[model samples]
Target: MRLSTVILPVRRWSEGGRDQWLRAESLGFHTAYTYDHLSWRSFREKTWFGAVPTLTAAAAVTSRLRLGTLVTSPNFRHPVTLAKELITLDDVSGGRVTLGIGAGGNGFDATTLGQEPWTPRERADHFGEFVPLLDRLLSEDSVSYDGTHYSAVEARNIPGCVQRPRLPFAVAATGPRGLKLAARHGQAWVTTGDPKLFEAGTPEQSLEAIAGQIGKLGAACEEIGRDVEELDKILLTGFTPDRGRPLESLDAFVDFAGRHFVLGITEIVVHAPIADSDFAADEKVFEQIATEGLAQLAG
Candidate 1:
């Protein structure tokens, strides 16, 4: 039931965005994550910083607010490189780093730049293979792997990560395979949306869908002989509405978040105002919304 904040796909990073997260730490946020997609949300533009480095910047200034990828693509980088990146960030964050890995979104952002296209099944298989390597690299001095799309030498990760065996790993999943993968391997399961109201659809339908997803995750854990209770479920939602939107007044964003977020796990992560709404105009607006939004969610 812990609350985490996230940066979404259709969002951009501004100086104001950086400040927004800084304020998040003092606001009592447990985790702060960002996307690592190459494709932009609206257009086909690329975001700055591949992913790990941007979090590096987030960790540099904040003493609290755990840093991680909202969901780093399994295909975008190799396991060795990913392990290295997670280790480095863990070092910088004093072991307060989590790694949110996933198959990534399928859009111009992921498949553009002449990258390969993977069937959903392929990505799930790849993720299943990728996760175990993370543990192997972190736990052992040397390792070997021979999988469908991966091959690693008996290479030593050298000194390992700051979090000892490895850092926590989370996943963003909404499909059968993704759900099972998230349940079997991920320390946590995160989804993107607004918890207060169905930012995407009717609230009742969304609630039903969310409850179904959680049930599937629990079933997946059962299939694998793992206890679903051992894992945490987190929803990444922009619960606080714009100042005067229809749901804005009724938003009681905090209470709404509590309602939807508690559907299964009894807790959820609430995202706030976006970073790209009005870059130039909302500089102060970002500060104001983030400050108040933090209090609303935390309180």
Candidate 2:
């Protein structure tokens, strides 16, 4: 299974963020990501940088590792504007960029934009329009369209993406509508499973919950007449804090990876041990994962 890590942009941009990404690449990570959020959870008061620029910088320095946002939502970004940025990032990364997108959540990103809270149905409808418009913008030139939530007026993508047609999209989903959207449009489907099940549960319990979620995704693919095997399933490890002990050691990570593999996850992205702003501590964890965890996998 391919391995990745989500480096949260909760810290200051100047504080070794670039160095940490560089270290991750040198240490054999397949891809590295930063969270796409304006302000996240309890870290709202903290310094947070934009995911696009952070990932762009990561792509500039790393040649081997693929770069992406953990997930970008349409809450605060226009699809047309984002498409232009993503294609440029794909070019700069030499086709090593993936767009991890979602229907957005009721978080600080939503309310802070001075937008009203949308109902679940409204969010799904918005996502339906958002993903397709982005697909057209990157794949076709001089696209003009109008939709309920977004519109593009004769938008010309003079030079298209390096990845051809468009860069890869890793779509995050859990609900039926979201799952179907992922099945229809995503190169990869990403999930963190049910939050309630993970809260105060063991690793084994979390695995079971994730398995159910994966099954739902498979069902969604079948309903849409899509081959489930053709889409990559990405499991987000340690996504919920209350999911018992975090996989901090190589053995822990290997065990987690093995379980996910058995559950049909082709890729797993682990969160680094929260080192706050300490890049050295973060680098140590990444180095060990490369040397020990990946070595264990290889062996």
Candidate 3:
């Protein structure tokens, strides 16, 4: 399985965030990601940077490692605007950008943007239009679309993406509707296991449950006549202390990745520890994890 690291822009100066991602690339990570949130919860009181610019800066600094947002939703972004930004990022990264998208959630982003509270079904409906229109706008020369939530009038995509047929999409999905959407449009499907299970269970249990989610994704693909193996599987953990702490130990991490690899996970994206203070300490801990983790994999 490929391995990735997510260096959050939370509480880090732009330079520190860029440095951490650079460090991740030096340590042999396959891809580097930053969280795409507008003032993430609790951390709202702290410094949080925008995902697009941070990723743009990251692309400028790193040459080999692929860069992207952990997942960007349609919460505060229109597909047309996002498509333009993504193409620019892809060009800057030399065609090394992956778009990780989701149905979005009710968080600080929604409220801050003055968006109405949307039900899960409504979000799914919005995504149904969002993905396809974005795909067309990126791939076609001039497109016109009138959808329920989004619209484009003869949109021009001049000097198209660095990657032909647009950039790769790593769609995040857990529910059936979302899974079907990902199967239809994504190059990869990303999940974080079952939230209920992860909250009350041990690390082993959470990791074990991911296989079930993979199975559900396969079923989703089958219903849509899409080949399951054609899509990459990515897991995003390390948000909670319980989820993040297990990977601190080298052996635990190797086994963690190995177990998911067996379940058909193509990549594991672990988040860097929140840098409330002592950024150096957080960096050191991640350095050890990445160093030993790669060594273990190589062995």
Better of 1 and 2 by TM-score: 2
Per-residue lDDT tens digits for candidate 3, residues 1-299, read: 77788877864544476678778789888899887988877677888889999889889998998998888998888988888899899999999999999988898877776778688888898888898888888888888989889999988888889999889999999888888888898999998777776556776677667777888899999998989999999988653224655356676778777767777888877776664542222556566767677567657
lDDT of 2: 0.80
Clashing pairs in 1: 1-267, 39-109, 193-237
> How big is the positional error of residue 38 in model 1, measured in Å on the Cα after superposition?
1.6
Local accuracy of candidate 1 as per-residue lDDT tens digits, 1-299: 46566654342446465676677787666777776776555534533445777788778888878887777777567887777777778888888888877776566554676677777787788877787777687767788888787778886777777776678778777777877877766788876533444444565665666787788888989998999878777765542232223124323545555566567554344444554542123334433444454456556
Best by lDDT: 3
Model with the higher TM-score, candidate 1 or 3: 3
- Which of candidates 2 and 3 is the stronger one according to lDDT? 3
Q: How close is each model in CA RMSD to the real structure? A: 4.4, 2.4, 2.3
**Which portions of model 1 miss their true places by more than 4 Å?**
8-18, 193-200, 238-251, 275-299
The C-alpha TM-scores of every prediction are 0.81, 0.92, 0.92
lDDT tens readout by residue for model 2, 1-299: 88888888765647777777887787787888888999888667877889998888888888999999879988888888988899889998999998999988899888887889788788888888999899899998779998878889999886989998789899998888888888888999998866776556566677788788788889998997888898899876655533323255566667767777888988878765565532223545556876578568657
Report, for every candidate in turn, its global Cα lDDT versus the true structure.
0.66, 0.80, 0.81
Worst 10 residues of 3 by lDDT: 274-283
